[model samples]
Target: MLLKKERLNDILTDMAKQARVYVPVSPDANDGGGVGKSGKAKMTRFELYSPGTAPNFDLVNTTMPPKDMLFPQTQKMYRYGFDTEGNAYIDIIHDSDEVVIFGMRSCDARSIECMDDVFLSMGYDDEFYKQRREKLATVAIGCASVAETCFCDSMGLDPNAAPGADVQLSPGVDGQSYVVVAQSEKGQALVASWQPYLEDSTAETTQVSCALKVNGDGLKDKLEQMFDHPIWEQLSKKCLTCGTCTYVCPTCHCFDISQENKMKDGERFRCWDSCMFSAYSEMAGNHNPRPTKMPRVRQRFMHKLCFFEDRYGKTLCVGCGRCVEKCPVALDITMLIDDIQAADLSKAEEVA
Candidate 1:
């Protein structure tokens, strides 16, 4: 089913009425008051307030991933209490909120898809993640403009095609609005229920702008070939071990689980973790497997590019380039791979 622009807004309003509607609405372009290049100015970061939390859908890409919606930064796992009568009880809080994420990019959607596989795996299924997954619905908007650091094309990811979205929208040729299409049963029901505002699909629906090359597969093979090379040490030298890359990445799924107690009453909690941390793989006896930065760096790529694929038949990276742009050392993964692929082996002897 297809929905026109006006119909889409009506559907959004209806969804909002039923549950919390989080759309991508652009923020105020100009600040209320600020100094210009002096006088101790309070500069603004547009990412500080994302449209993803707004009611209107008008922003480009959200600075942060939608993971916060599923795996919240801070959430209570369960509450416990004990009476003097010697009765103890624990109340586990399983989420039951309906959430709708609009204007999410295809890469971000794919990131969720990859995470579902991990979070829902047997022997360690996360109940919180499952609850969020059951209540969340994703609506993807195709990319009309590509960022310089974006290389989803190299990873064989299509910015215009979101296999994980319940509903997908592309800009129409007329440029007045979007050409929306439903990819899931939920989306079809949504369009059908909001049929009063929807319109028939037209020829213009096929004319969306193409996403640039991600080259993820090509880069994966090249990385595999150079796995044992010394490039990791050189590229990772300036790294601060901040773990910002994994935190921002859409498909990085490593996490740590810990239990907290308050005098006989306690709860277990799960939080985000990363390979960059020195304590990530440390054993109880003080034996650390991946103690060095280079090994940790190597582990990140290996897990995403090789190990994940072996398990799930697909690479974990979506080629969003968040790691490249957010790295403190200016370590661009794409540029790093490009440099490695183009490295001249023979030149080392002559230079020596």
Candidate 2:
């Protein structure tokens, strides 16, 4: 099926009538200049599509990953309160809206697979994550242009395809349409609805390749033996421990659970957390094991490359380049991988 560029808004308008459609939005307006107060451009991110809202399909990738839709930054678990008769009541809160992520890239699609491992697999299922995952649909677009910092190909992802997405869209000839393929029942239903806007025609996809590449082969094995090595110390020296990398990462899923209370009611919630923060590892007795920046920095990278692979059979980093593009101090993960590949592990300590 070919989805023409001219009919995109109409298709979106039609889809929005049934579900909350999220598309990458870039506010590069005629007068807005797109710069936010933080000096960063009003960056591209998945936004809920409403009437008259413009979705930017030209963007390579969103600065903010779409992970927030599935696993929110601060999700209220439940509410508890005491009634006037002194009876305690509890209410479970689950906000599962039928949603579709349109125009997501392949890296974004893979990251959702990673989250599935953490939340829905391994003989355990989180009700909160399951609630959202079950109702969500993905429409991934093939990358026609690669960013300078993009390394998805090196991280074992295909830039031209998202196998996990329900529907895959790739730019067609002359950039006039998208070659759409439905890979699932949900995708079939979605594409069926777009039948009014699609054409029964065949077309070729515009292929693309990432400019940045890294040798990640054996990186996990090498890092396992180098945990106590001096490389971590060297890498930690320049890091400001700002946790910007985790915030912008597509696969970083660490979170902290807490609660907010009112006079007679309270709600438990979980918000995104960062291992780069010293307090994240603080014990109840104030015994901080990862008290210094060295261990904190080591934990972040080790989890991304080694620890996560050991548990999930895949690396956590999706190579979306959000961290690389947003990092204030130029602390790049590709550079770290390069360093680890070159490190001499002759006397490297055993895996911790």
Against the true structure, whose lDDT is highest?
A: 2
Candidates' C-alpha lDDT: 0.70, 0.90
- Positional deviation of 7 in candidate 1, in angstroms? 5.2
Q: 136-190 in candidate 1: lDDT tens per residue?
A: 8778877766666677767767777887898887766555567678889877765
Candidate 1 — which residues are off by over 4 angstroms? 1-9, 25-58, 121-124, 203-214, 218-227, 343-352
Ten contiguous residues with the weakest lDDT in model 1: 43-52
Provide the clash count, candidate 2: 0
Against the true structure, candidate 1 reaches a TM-score of 0.83
- Per-prediction TM-score: 0.83, 0.96
Model 2, residue 280: what's the lDDT? 96
